[model samples]
Target: MGEQVSKQATIVGMLWTGGTPKAKEVEENMASYFNVLQGFLLYFYGSTVGAGPTLSSNLHQSVMQVVNSSFNLMKDSVSSYGSRSKDQKVAVPVLVGKVWEACSGLKKAPATNIAAIGRAMTQVAVSMKDVLREMRELKPDSGGQEDDQQTSGGVAGDGDGNEDDDDDVGDMGNDLSPEEMKVAELAMEVVSDLLLVIKELIRSITGLLKMEKADTSGSFVDSLEKLLKSSQVIGAQIDELGACLYPPQEVSTMEAALKKISSSLNGIESEVEDLKGSTDTFVKACSGLRGSIKQLELVLSCCSVGQLEEQLTNTSLSH
Candidate 1:
């Protein structure tokens, strides 16, 4: 598993730094990386529970490093392809979707490793947010200087004769192409899905931390601290996503969903903070915590789908 992960990471790094590869090549590398990630996640889920603490910890760290590197490579690809063809530009969001698919498998990751997985997912979410911002800024090529000159000359000559017609044409030109809008929508959906995953993982770790058996040793306390730190990182990532470059009107639904997730995370943080070395109180709280998280995840999922549908409707209407 380690060898496979190393090889996959190397492929992603090469693709990221190496000059623009063919879209097919990028897709293949992303698929390969996803395969390796799935294998690692399955192994961790099936066997990590029985492994000793040292071994489990090592495995968790190794997997987290690989996930972080892979997502960084995806982000680099998005930035690196800024001047490339549309195909290459679109490939990044597709790769991001694949990464999200891989991350969804982490719901089955070992309880002990949930914190590490959450941290890695947070890194990926942050990078995706950056890519989404870049995508939103994309403007279709307006031909060249000649085209600009022609447009300006036409507008100048029109004066009051055809001013409204020129204004409508200009508006049409500035509107995002269908493909570009699709890419933006894809990026937003992937970011939203990742947030859901992070929320669930944190909630899972919190529940485990509050278990009676979990407090038998110092390890539980250590895990709780790690969860707290990871939660903070996720909270910051959520804030960044909420502050995306899109106009507030466009992202209002997403922002509202993020705000709800942020509140849930804060509540979890408070629960962790109020731990007074008592197992009974922790157990009582754990009973309802998972349910609350599930409710939030459902709400987030619905909001994301609605936002995407609304965007699609607007895009179609503009066309």
Candidate 2:
């Protein structure tokens, strides 16, 4: 991995300048170094595959430490790049890729799959939060940019404009600036994707439960449905808000989507509650049946003793 990374670095170096590296070459070198360091850190941190308080606490703390350091480095670099022309946005892609590459190092991590997923989710969340923070510092309360009103092909609200699109429904610490709102919208999109991932996780876990004969006979199935519905509700809201905030028309579509998701979530919540009630009733019925069986055994014992006594008395009389 180190050799491959070094080769990529050499290629990048070659592309940056014709041949002779100068003072400006230091910037590229610095970026590459940071990128490699971040990936290495995540790789090492995520590799530990034990449990208990030893080296296998949740990856949150260790990964977070990497994130904090990475963010600081990126902040300085982005600040330095801010003065460049819009055409110079080529640097943005490299930075974005580096950040994600670092994050991807935490991928396929050991320990537990659930924990791995959680770590991935946390990484995305922290990245979004940092972006929002940067936006706040830049624009203060700049309402937010409008949403995309049309796609390149002319579909309404298809995302042509420079509007920020997000699908996140959870609290973004309030006081959202336009840029922050945009970040929030992107976060929502990330969440929408994450929901699909989570659904897959649930399916895997459910199968595990069945294999272990672990009674998922609880409200688990219904609860899962409810969660999926809620996620849909949130995604729909972000789309609706984005359409409103952006350009192009067709509010009806967004509105209908929101309504459908909301209704589904409400329905699922009700079903989950009913499932709980049913399980409770089934447990009570089993208990009652058990008690009746014990009582019937007692009655049968007494009847047998009475018949035996009568037989003994008759035998004595005959003798």
TM-score against truth, every candidate: 0.28, 0.24
RMSD of each: 18.4, 26.1
lDDT of 1 by residue, 163-230 (tens): 46766575554444343344345545545554454455445554553453454555554545555455
| Candidate 1 ranges beyond 4 A from true positions | 1-47, 50-115, 128-132, 135-150, 153-248, 251-255, 271-319
Candidate number achieving the greatest lDDT relative to the actual structure: 1
Q: Indicate the TM-score of model 2.
A: 0.24
lDDT of 2 by residue, 272-317 (tens): 3453422443334334433433332333334333454476678889
Clash count (model 1, backbone only): 0
Pick out the ten consecutive residues of candidate 2 with the lowest summed lDDT. Answer: 138-147
